[model samples]
Target: MAEKAESLDLIWEVTEIARLIGRTERQTFHMLQSGQLPAKKVGGRWVAERGTLIRFFMETAA
Candidate 1:
């Protein structure tokens, strides 16, 4: 489905990132604010690359 392609995007919003990692937006925002996730704030919005998140979780899961 086209929905799956969202994960292939280079930039993702907090909600998207939350879904990717199977967490809630509140939790994802906390992780981003605490520097637990590799991301940056641009134009007052949180953004992250799907690949980076995937690899980060993959590595952490090991």
Candidate 2:
């Protein structure tokens, strides 16, 4: 089962995000590099805020 929002980590790695979005890791990385996805590099790994990603897609969705 998934953790509750209050217990969930605010940050998500590229692989996790990829799974969430139903895309492969490579595709997710490409989107991140091309500015299509919002993320930041920390300690050599790509990460994004759960809330930020949710809002981004919600606001920009067609």
Q: Quick one: best TM-score, which candidate? A: 1
Candidate 2 residue lDDT tens string, 1-62: 45575664556678898886678989998998898988888888888877788888889885
Where's the lowest-lDDT run of ten residues in candidate 2? 1-10
Candidate 1 error regions (>4 Å): 1-8
Candidate 1 local lDDT, 1-62, one digit each (tens):
78876555666589888998899999999999999998999988888887888999999999
Q: What is the lDDT of candidate 1?
A: 0.87
Give the clashing residue pairs of candidate 1, or none: none
For each candidate, what is the lDDT?
0.87, 0.80
Evaluate model 2: give its lDDT: 0.80
